[model samples]
Target: NTFFQISDLEKKLEVEKEKTAEVSGDDDQEDKVSMVTLSGQEMSFESRGELEKAIKEMTSVVSKAVAAKEFRKADDTQKDVDALIKLREKLPSVFELEKQLKVMKQDMDKAIKAKKFALAEELHDDVEKLEMRLKTERALQPPPPKDLAGRDTHSVKSVPVVATVASAASVRSAATTPAKQPVLPKQPLEVSGPSSDKTVKHLRPSRPLSATEDESILSITQMLATKRGNAALLVGPTGGLAGILTDTDVTRRVVAKDIDPATTSVNEVMTPNPTCVTMGDSALDALSTMVE
Candidate 1:
């Protein structure tokens, strides 16, 4: 079956080579072979080490092509490798092939201790198969594609062009749309309650935590004491507030959830995109916004 597949691939590769020859009008010369599969997907190569470290994953077709001095056919298998590598990229880090192999190794070790040679041998083979897959995946991953401006002359920027077209369509739609009717603004709601001299502006100034601060040392109680504020804002690298940490946040997120203050980050436990009111807003309007 493998031999037949190789033969078929060689035929397809021959067709591709012939087409390429017609386009370039140049004789075949020795250049580093970049594989494209018979299916027409481009082959990927991440690093030299990945290709050199393991050749066992190389299919029979690839091996035969190299042996027969058919570098083009061999290189075409790189496309298959590229597909495998991309699949590997999408795999979840927490649960991966390596984890399965590790569990299998543990089981095999136990089988050996119990003198269960049959089970051990079976598990060993499984481990070998998984390891081979991992090695091959690493070898096949291509480098990330370049940006539009940074791409080589031959590379296309279809994504950027699409984005630009979408943006232009949005602008055109906005321009063509009828203007919304002006709303007759209603008078502000009047609360019958007694007027208070105190306002939101009288509240403690907002304190912020730098994005680079160590989470292990971050404590809401400590922040409140040091910053002299009831709420602690998590400031991003750009000096914009990312999230807000307060006594209420600690009560609900940390104390209620039984999370240790020493181990938790302010951003992890904080409220994101806290409500705000403009300076012109009355105390009642500010309170309404907060309630809403």
Candidate 2:
């Protein structure tokens, strides 16, 4: 009977030991899995490093696409860059969590070396919890701002260049229309000229030219010289007057500012939303508006 009782006690102890070992093994496995998972997902939140690399790669691709005249691919790549920017903005900063994790790991190592098994185990659990928390924060960060392209918008520091280009093209088309089409009035009326007494409509219309907002100031100046005109009308998408680029504008806004007209755009110096007079208005009235 005594031997049987001793055998039963030994069997119970063995079973308990196996259970403890199984739990410890499971914890160890979980820790390994957590670390592996975090590393795999590092690219998603390690944005500063990853984003720079991605932008550089994509910029090269964009340049190539543009060179190939594959505009669609270039535009698509720009959208991808915008998306990456949003993703970066949406992720919480991991700097603090990372610092805590590093310190905790160091402490855990020290505890183990000092034979403080209980403290080490506790620290290990804390580290796992911290890792889980870090993951959650990254995954559940607030949505990116409404204006994802705000940075790009700010960089250009003006109206939409594409729309401005289209408007400019329309002005060019109007300028080059056939003789049968109703001609637009000449710009920068010469008040001292013989035609000054005539109403705007009675004055003979000439081949009025235009310049795009994006056109370099030097190029537009050359165009004016080539056409022997003092001014070019800046038209909008609807063919309505958006602004005017004149020799005076170049002299004042460009030359006075010491701006590099070769690198500067007409848009930067042209008078925006210029005042206008009706066809019935006398040349004097038009000149007065110009003076104002």
Candidate 3:
């Protein structure tokens, strides 16, 4: 005639408490003493201040996330806090829990009124996240809060250091090592192009940008403009410097053969290494080479 057996209901209630403990309790939390029933079953809830600390933690994460330019995370956090508040609204005494939501509300409002829309958005998102957490806390149970004074039982004490004994050794080495002799400075090389004003405007390529070894031939034409019987070789990766295919060379070879430069590479035209100077070579040596 009874709706359900009392002994059977007690056993079911005990099983529910165990399940809630596993979900909400970490290793550090104490076991629940009182079997308070909420949502038609027995499970413990955190004390007011401890509960507030958790909400603050969620909000703090929201703030840091917003600072890091991670908006998607901020959105998820907003969802959690929103759920908490909606559950808090359903509680009977509500008490400090409702006040916590109000403070969060005010903080959000101030941010919005100041037109600090980004900050406001983060705070608003944080409140919504707190609401969600509370909804979860109500559905499942949260661990019981610590003592009112929140005493830390862990002791602070100095760790003793063990001493290490070392064996003494006798010194037998001589005073010092001798100093090394100074080295003579290496001489600088001299590179001569021209002393006169003929090739002044022309730009010459000393080295190639890439490994192609092609020489840029611009300034040399302008530089050689005033010279009468002066013609010099443009040496590069191809061949002899003076072994050039100039207008004179082209007219004689390609034009006479009815061929085109587009069909030929600069290797078919430019002169290779004519003469090069070493670092020890003098200006007088340079003049003699030029004359040669």
Query: All candidates' TM-scores?
Result: 0.30, 0.31, 0.19
Clashes by residue pair, model 2: none
Candidate 2 residues 1-292, lDDT tens each?
Answer: 9999999999999999999999998865443211111114323333333443454465566667877889988887755544443443333234446667899999999999999999999999999978886776555432223232453355354335544655665577577774624433432232225344655556555667885555678888888888898898765433444457887777756786688989865655566555555454466766655544
Each candidate: RMSD to true structure?
A: 25.1, 24.5, 34.5
For each predicted model, how many residue pairs clash, with residues at least 3 apart or on different chains? 5, 0, 25
| Model 1 lDDT per residue over 1-292, tens place | 9999999999999999999888675422211234455777564433332432222254445556777888987787644543443332333121245567789999999999999999999999878966776675554433222221243332234335545655675555467753622221211111113224334445533544444222432555685777576766555333344446667667855686677778754544554445444332356766665443
Tell me the TM-score of model 3: 0.19
lDDT of 1: 0.52
lDDT of 3 at 94: 23
- Candidate 2: count the clashes: 0
Candidate 1 positional error at 149, Å: 32
- Indicate which candidate wins on TM-score: 2
What TM-score should be assigned to candidate 1? 0.30
lDDT of 2 at 280: 45
Higher-ranked by lDDT: 2 or 3: 2
Candidate 1 ranges with C-alpha deviation above 4 Å: 1-217
For candidate 3, the clash count comes to: 25
Cα lDDT over the full model 2? 0.60
Clash count, candidate 1: 5
1-292 per-residue lDDT for model 3 (tens digits) = 2556877888899999998888775632432222322224333334332333434455556557777878888766644533332232233112233456779999989988899999988888778856765554444422222321132221111111101111110111111212321111111111112222222113332331221213223333333443421433544222222233244434533465564455443323232223444322345655555444
